[model samples]
Target: MELQIGKYTARISVLPPIHPKFRITPEPAAPNSTDGEEEQIEAEPISGFTCIIGYTSGGGEVSERLITCRSLRAHGTGLTIGAICHAAKGFRAFRVDRISAVSDPHTGEVIGDGSYFSRFAVKSSDKARAPSGGWGLTPSRMRTLVAGLNVLSFIARCDGYWHALEDEPLANFIERLWMRKDWEGQPPVAAILDHAKRLAPDSSIFFASLETIFGSRSSTRLLISSVRELIEADGIIQDQETNWVLAMQQHQEEYYARKGLLGSI
Candidate 1:
C-alpha cells in the first residue's frame, strides 16, 4: 500500500502477526456512570510506538495520519484508539474499522487490523512489570533526554536546511540509549523532528532554554558528540554548524564556572 499526503509518500507492507489470538477486554464502567456513555478502560500506556493510518472520517473524508497511540479500548464491534496525531498535533480517537491501513512510521510495514490491537495488548502486558510507564527512564531523566535531543536538533539545522541524512544520526543516538526494535515505549521521533524543524529558525532563544536542563558532564559530552555526527552526516561542514557547537561548549563552561566547578568538555 502506498500512502501519499502532499509531497510525502510511504510504501507499507503487511507483516504476519506474532500473536493472532490476542484480544482486549473493555474495563467495566464506573459505579455512578450511566449507560451509553463511553467508558475509558485504561491499559498500560504504550508510548513511542507510532503508526500511519489511512482513515475515513464519519463525514467520509479520507486522509492519512501519523499517530502515537496512548490507549486502546473495545468499542462495540470494533476498537477505539486514543493517540496523539502528529499532523493534528493533538489527541484524537480513531476507530479501527474506519482505518484502511496501519503502517509503521519508520519502516512502513503494515500491521494487520487484528494484529495491530493484538500487538498492543501483548506489549502492554510484557511491559507491565516495568515501573516506568514508558522508556524505563524517570520523569526527570526523560525531560533531560528530550532537552538533549532538542540541542542536537538545533545543531543539525544550524546550516539553515535540515538534511535528510541528519535523521540517521538522531535515530542511531536514540537506539543506543534504548535497545528496542519493536518501537513500543520508544521516544516520539517524528514529534521531535517536527518540533526541531519549527524551532530551528530561532535557535538562540530555544537553545538557551534547553541548555539549563543539562547539568552533568557525561550527558553534555554525549550531546556534543551526537551533534558532530549529525552535522557530518550530510558530508558538507558548514561554518554555522561549527559555530553553534563552540557556542554550546562555551555556554556550558560558563555555567559550570558560575557554580565553582570545572566544566571541561
Candidate 2:
C-alpha cells in the first residue's frame, strides 16, 4: 500500500502471521472450567518482530522504516509500540494510529486491514525503556510542540533570511518552556528547524495540524506567546511575520469560540 503524508510518499508492506523470529504463546486455561464450555485465551506479550512500516512523524514528515518492535503499550485511546528503528538508529515510540501502513519486511506484501498488531495488547508498564534523549512525551503533545516549532521556523524565515540571533533563543525557549527536565539531551531541534524551512513556503498545513492538536487554553496561550517572542528575537519583526501571527491568533480564537471555549483562553 502507498500512503501520502505531507510531501513524502511511502510504500507499506504487510507481515505474515508466522515468521521465523516471531512467536505467539496461548494463555493457559482457567482452573475448574467445564469440559463443554468454551474458554477464552489471550496471546502472550509480543517480544520482538521485524516489520516494514510507513510512519508519519509528529512534524508531518513521513518515512518508511524497517523496525524491530520490542513491545506494545496502551496509549490514550490507541496503542504505542516501542521499537528499534533502523532509520533512526535508536529506540522510538510510535503510535499505532500514526502507522500509515505495515508490511512484511522480506516480501513487501501490504497489510490492508492493519489488524495484526491490534490483537496483541499490553499494559503501559510492559513497554521497553527508551534510551536517553527520548522526550518521554505523548504522541499528541509531541505533535503540538513540533507544529509550534514549525510556526516559529516560518517566522524566522519571513524576511527571506534566517537570522543567526534567533537560533539560541529558539533552542533555549524550547528547552525551558516545553521540555521536561528529566528528558536527557535536546530534541531534534536542528532537524525540525531545517525541515521547517523546506516547508515554509506553504505552512498552512502545520497551522491546521496545530489547530486540531490544541488540547487546552494554557497550551494555546503558550504557543502564541512563544511565537511573539520568536518574532522579536532577531530585533526585526517583519510585516509578514506579524500578520501571520495575528491570523493564527484569530483562527485559534474562532476555533475555541466555535467549541464554546472562548472564555477559557
Candidate 3:
C-alpha cells in the first residue's frame, strides 16, 4: 500500500501471515490543510529476530494487551514477536510508517527497523526519600523551622498557602521565622510557611507556636474543644494548674515504674 505523510507520498507494505515475503515501501501522502512538509520515516531490521508488519485496528476496538516498557517475565511472546494493531496482542508493536529513523547502536548499521516497534531499556530517576507521617521533627526543631518560614518564600512555591495553614496571625509570625539559621536547606519549611501566610496573613507568634506543633490554630482549637468536652463529661474537680501537677506526678510514677520502682496510681 502507498500512504502520504506530510508532503511526501511513501509506500507502505505488509507481509502475508502464511509465506511471508515482505517488500516495504514509503507510505504515500494525502491532501492535508495544515502545512506542506515531507515526513521522514524509517525502520530497523534485526538479523536473528522475526519481523512482520500489518495495519492496526482503529482505537478502542483492539485488545488492551500492549508490549509496554515493563517486564519480560512472560514466557514466549503470547502474540508473535512483531505484529500490528489488534494483532499486537502481547507482541512488541512499533509503528514502521511513523518511525523517524533507525540505527544499530553496537554495530552502527543503518537498518530498516526504526519504523518497526522494537524493545528498548527504560529507567527512572526519582529518589525515594524517607516517609514523612506518624512522627515529625523533635518539638524544638519543629518550632525553629516554623519560625524560619515567611510569606515571600511561600508565594514563590506557588502552592495553596492560605488553605494549607489558615491563620493570619500565624502567617505573619512565620514570615518573621524566615530569618532563622536552622531552616537552611529545608524546602518544606519555606513551603509550609508560604502556605500559612497565604491562608492567614495576619497570624501571630502564639498561633505560630501552636501551629508549629499542631499544624494550625484551628486544629489546636479543636484539640482544646475536645479536652474541654472530656473535662465537662468527667466532672473533673481540678483546674489547669492542678492538672499540670497531676500530669507531673503521673510522669514521676511512670519514671519509677520504668526503673523497677512501684507506687500507687
Candidate 4:
C-alpha cells in the first residue's frame, strides 16, 4: 500500500497468510433445521467487535450489513465467522475467506463509499455469474485466496494523465504494472487485456476484496490511488472526481493521524 503524504509516500505491504483452511465443507443440512434451529458450528468467533461484513452468497451474489464479529472457528483451509447480520434479522455465520470488508460501524465508510468508489460510475451491467459451489464454498472465495496469495501488485502514481487517447489506458496501466514487477511474468499483452476485461466492474467488490486481502487502512490507500488512475483515464478530470479524490486524501490524513502514522510525518 502506498499513501501520498504531502510530497512523499508511505509504503506498506500486508502479506497474505498461508493456510489451507479457506474452504467450507459442511454436512448436509437436516431438512428440519429451518424450524428456527441452527446448524452445529465447529466453534464460535470471539465476540465484541461490531462492524460490517460483505458476504458472498451461493454464487456471485453479494450482500452487505452491519455485523458483529462474534466467534471465529476453523472451517476448511480457512475459518468461519459467527456474526449477527444487521441488514436482516438475526445471528448468522459468514465464511472468513469470503468476507469483503470490515469497517467501523459509526465512523468509517463501508469500504467503498469513500474516494475509491467515486470513479467508475455504475454501468447497470448485468450481474456477473459466479461458478456453482454449495455445501462447501463459493467460487469467489477460492479466487480471493488465489489472488491474495499471489498478488499481481500494481505500483504507479500520478504521472502523465489528463491526455486524450482512444486506446485502453487503464488496461495498459495494469499490464505495465505487472510486468514491471515481473510478478505475473510476461504474459502476452492479450492475456492481460482479457484479465482486465474479466475484472469485476463493481468497484465495491474490488475494494472489499482488497480489504479482505490486506488490512483496512492498507486497502484504503491502494483503492484510492488505483481509482484515481481510473478517474483520470478519460484524460479529463471531472469536478466530482477531483473532489472525491480530495476528500479521500483528507480521509487518509485523518486516518493516519488517528493511527499515529502521521505523528512524525
Candidate 5:
C-alpha cells in the first residue's frame, strides 16, 4: 500500500507475520486481582493479537480497541501498531511505555503485555538502528527522525515565537532533519518553521510520532543531548530558548518516570 508522507508518496510494505519479529510466546499468567474485581469471559485471542488497547492519550488511559496502529508488531525493545487516529488516520506511531493496558476487545478482559525494554538499565546508542534516508515508508517502520524533528519544532514554538531560529546548532539541526528523502530538499529554514507552526493547531501526529521516537532509550538520550547542545551552542539563552529547553527537559523527566529510571536534572 502507498501512503502520503509529507510531500512524498511512500510504498508501505507490511512485514510478514512469521518474520521472527512478530512471534508471540506464552507469558506467565497474570495474577488474579485479589481485591475482588469482576471477572470477564475470555474470548478467543485474535491471531493478529487485536485487542482492547488502553493507552495514555496524555489525558489518561483510553481503552480504545477500535484504535490500532497500522502494521502492528512487537520486537525486542518496542511495539508498533496501526494507530487508527483522527490526526493522519492511516497510522500514527506509538511508544509502548505510553500504553497502560491491552485487553480482549470482545469481553473487555485485560491482558498484561511484555516488558522487553526494562531488562536493561542504561541503553547503549547501538541498541536500535538509526534512521535511513526515508526510502520505503513501509507501514511497519515509521519515520523516527522526522518525528524527533517534530518534537523540536514544538519546543521551539512553546515560547510563543514559533519561527525559525538564527542560532547555529538549532539551524543545523533543522537543516539536517529536513533533508530526509520524504521532505522537500531542505527548503528555506524560515519557511520550514512557518509550515511547522501552521501544522501545530491540529498536529496530533506530531505528538504521537514524537512519543514513539522516545520509546528507544538511545533515541530519547540523543534527542535530549541535541536539545542541550542546540540551546547552549550560542552561549546566550534567550527567553525563547529557555522555554524550549525547559519543555524538552520536562519531557525527559516524564520519560525517566515512565522507565522507572533514576532521573537527574
Candidate 6:
C-alpha cells in the first residue's frame, strides 16, 4: 500500500500468532455433562497487527457485530484497532474478539460488529457512459482500451512490471489519475509517451493520428502497430467515420473527466 493514512504510510507486516484449537466430539461411552461445554479454549499468542484470514461478505467483514469467529483481526482481545482488511464499513480495521473488552471512542460501549465503510480515495461524478462522438469510446470501450494497454513500470532489477492499475476499472483509474493531476505539468502527450516508451522499453502507447497531437512523427506506422497489437486478440477494429479531430478532442475531454481532471473538459 503506497497510500498515506493520517501520519503513517501504509505498510504490510507479518504478525506472529498461535494456532486456534478446534473441539473434537466426545465419544458416546463418556459420561455426558453439559457443565464443561462452554469452556473457553485459548489459542497461541499472536504478535502485533496483521490481517486475519477469514470469510466475510465479498471478501470483507460486517461491522460492529461479532459472529463467534475463530480469529480476531489477527490480534488478541483488548487491543484497539489500528486498521481492518476487507471490511466494508468499520474502522480502518478492528478485532472482533476484542469487542467484549474494548470500547468505541465515540460510543464508549461494547457493540457487535457491523458494516460502516468510510474512507475511500476517489468519488464518481456520473455512473452512465459518455456518448460515442469523435474519439469518444463508450465506458465499456474505454475500459477495454485502458485494460489492454500495459503501461510501463520499474520494479527494481527483476524486469519491471507496468503499473496499469489492474485492480481498478477505467473509471477508478481515471479517478486516481485525475486526483493526482499527473498530466498537468507534462510538456506534451507525444513527449510523455515517447519518454515512457524509451525508458520502459517494454511499454506500448496507442492513438490514431499525429495531427491529433502537436508532435512531429515521420510516420504513423508505430501508432498503427501499437493499435494492431492492442486489438489483435480481441477482434476486428472499427474506425469512426465522423470528424476524427473533433471526436478525438471529445474523447480526450471525456477521458480527462473520467480521471477526475475537472478543469479541461
Best by lDDT: 1
Which residue runs does candidate 6 get wrong by more than 4 Å? 1-137, 151-158, 161-265
Per-residue accuracy of model 6 over 125-243 as CA lDDT, tens digit each? 42445432212333333222222221211111012222233122322333333233232232233422322222211111112112222121211223333323332222432232112
Candidate 5 C-alpha error for residue 261, in Å: 3.3
lDDT of each: 0.53, 0.52, 0.28, 0.37, 0.40, 0.25
Worst 10 residues of 1 by lDDT: 7-16
Question: RMSD in angstroms, all models?
Answer: 14.0, 16.3, 26.9, 17.0, 18.0, 21.5
Please, what are the lDDT tens digits per residue for candidate 4 over residues 208-228? 233343334433333444555
Supply the TM-score for candidate 1: 0.44
lDDT of predicted model 4: 0.37
Question: Which window of ten consecutive residues has the lowest lDDT sum in model 5?
Answer: 38-47
Model 2 per-residue lDDT tens digits across residues 98-217:
888876654456653234576445344433443211244443334455555555665666556667777765675466545532344566666544333332312333345446435555
Per-model TM-score versus the true fold = 0.44, 0.44, 0.16, 0.31, 0.35, 0.16
> lDDT tens digits, residues 1-265, model 3?
1222222112111111222233233333334421211121111111112222333433623122211111111124322223222232222334333333333322333345433333221112312332222013332433333322322222211222122223333433333333332333433444453222322111122222223324333333333333233233324323432342243234435445665655422
lDDT of 6 at 208: 18
Backbone clash numbers for all candidates listed: 0, 6, 41, 12, 6, 21
Compared with the true structure, what per-residue lDDT tens digits does model 1 show for residues 1-265? Answer: 1212212111111111222222222234346433221222221223223566788899998777766554566778667777655565445778888888776544455755533553333222434244333245543444455556556655665565667898878876666544422234667666545433332212322244345444666556666677779989999989877766666666666677878887555
Instruction: Give candidate 2 misplaced runs (Cα > 4 Å).
Output: 1-136, 179-201, 263-265
- Residue-pair clash count for candidate 1: 0
lDDT at 56 for candidate 3?
Answer: 42
